[model samples]
Target: MCVADGGVKTDRLSPAMVDKLTFLRGVGKQFWDLTDARIVNRNITMLRLGTLLLLCGSVFANELTINKIEDAAKAGQFTNIKIGNIQVPAGQTLHLKGLKAGTKIDFVGKVTFGFKQWEGPLIKIEGKGITVTGSPGHVIDCDGKRWWDGKGGNGGTTKPKFFAARLTDSSISNLNVKNLPVHGFSINSCQKLAITGVNIDVSSGDYANGAHNTDGFDVGSSSDIQIKNCNVKNQDDCLAINSGKNILFQGNTCSGGHGISIGSVGARKDNVVQGVIIKDNVVMKSTNGIRVKTVLNAVGSVSDVTFENIKLVDISKVGITVQGNYLNGGPKGEPTGGVPIRDLTIKNVYGNVLPKGTNILVWVKNASNWKFAFRTLWEVKDKIWRRTIKQDSDAQWRGPGQCFADHPQPRATRFTFP
Candidate 1:
């Protein structure tokens, strides 16, 4: 209840949002409140101070359409939440939890659920300074093909888990998710979270009952997390920081998954993945472009990670995959650093893979500064760097450039730059 001018302030709300603000339909007293109130412009967007608020009163009742949501997880009894055209109910959960710390949820139409098979998140949104958004031709359609049975979440039909962001100091913007039956945004236990322009479209699960383990952004134990400029087309791991710390996966754009990762990171309980920053992204036709799996023989530790200026297209399997031996379900030969990958950083990760792909595949074991993160210091001469490091002529390579290939394992190193 915030009118602020000559009236309204209900002690920080919650008498059921002060009886829903006494049905505030006062068309134009022009006292719309959410802090620093002042507006006539209809194209609203105050992203931080009161976030995506559209508490209509004039401009043709700006917007307030909530169409039956059985008390959408009782969004702290409202401060503004417009959703419209909802469906939700098949092992339900559109639960937008305890808001009111500055709540302002918006979505502006078309959201659906209702496909059974339980264990879903379907959509869970915890709170503490919240502001989830989407308006602008919104569409959070997780009709994931009625449980795309190509086995996601590791099984035959128990698919569920579409969004469960338990936030803190939150902010989620421009969400436009579509078709993802397994995982899409599970940013766990967040703190200062900031996700922008999200667009996780499982490109229709990419054909024939596909889109396995969906996974496009699955951050765990989140700390000051910031996932920026998103756009993911998934299959699995298009941004997966299994444990976090000052995390920031920036300027994103991933395609056909398994691209930006960090931790297959042992069993849980905050498996130690400190300060990560995967910057200036773009990993197209993916399958691995700067991955960092750390598991087998589990135990924790992955420090100060950084993979800057990414960008890799056509990557079909490996274009910088730093593994510490995942396990049982892939990569388990003999890596027992039991985690220890400190001060890691792989810079200027340029493109091209898929000639059986494999250009930098360090099979970890105590990786510190992992080869100075590939010594990126190019001046560019030396015959154009020996024709770009001999264009991968089956890299039985060395370093300082005559790089890539022939490490077959045991501290594996397969390079490729430019």
Candidate 2:
């Protein structure tokens, strides 16, 4: 029995259901009065009455169950819907678009997407004022082994991207995603969206390095977004902010991937990532810990960014990197100073790096008003810090207690050259 905006629909209830309820109430009072006279008779009558009341209450419960993806697509603006376990066929996508305001979707079981070798998004969700939540063990299996060939989106078979979300005032929480072929979540054009407790497990790709560009969350053109309490084990960036404002990423654990990042920004003139807060996160055994990369020839800016209370352990390469000459997945071209980074703050970022790991690498052409409070806690075998341009550029280095400290020592030899 389900209740919608219209009315209750129950096969057992007759047209005089209201009258029946009134009569049941009168009978319940009589049973109470009879309790003083015949105790056993009143007790049996009360038990039967309680069972009928329970059934009546269920008739008005507000929840709908959907067993198929098509059923969800055709459902008309339900306030609460439960999605049952189902397998999405190959070469097809499961899309839930244009959900009504205040709608809540609950996932009770796993959803397995069939394997395919196409440029596709296996799941797409778009709506306003919606919330999609899952139970503790709910999973979305992408079956990526059918497309893994040691090359991800770079070459080999063209695999589908896992999920795409375009939402406003919405949230997605407590979902476990696994075996993505290429990238994970693509969040675009969303406002006030909160994503929490999501787990992306692509650890199998580490065997022989089969997964290439399997990023965790690729955020673009969004604002007031919060991504928190998530765990990701992939091959690429755990969270990449391409363009956004007022974004907060906190309390996330990342491993076996490129760590949290901001850009590859400045590809377009409108590409800008500002007012971001990345705090209380852990990165372990990743290629890079925290990075901000801007394309050399592009035009834009990255400003007002804060990284606080972050812990990096066993970082394979550079722990902290800020570069302006980024291109084709690496920093190789001449930095043109087109994209200026300003008002950056790094606080309480303590970490340990592997042997031959560089701690801090900065090659920006124009930067200003930056503060670094990396006391002496950061441990690395190679250089503690290195910068391409000489001369102080208005940036300040402070100790653990905000005391003025000397600049970090330079590397013995530069690693990359333009």
TM-score of predicted structure 1: 0.33
Report the C-alpha displacement of residue 378, candidate 2, in angstroms: 20
Candidate maximizing lDDT: 2
Expressed as tens digits, the lDDT of each residue in 300-323 for candidate 2 is 888999998889888877778887
RMSD of each: 17.2, 9.6
Residue-pair clashes per candidate, as listed? Answer: 2, 0
Instruction: Report the C-alpha lDDT of model 1 over 372-401, residue by residue, as the tens digit.
Output: 344542222121111112234543324333
User: Model 2: residues >4 Å from true position, as ranges?
Assistant: 1-62, 374-418
lDDT of 2 at 86: 80
TM-score winner? 2
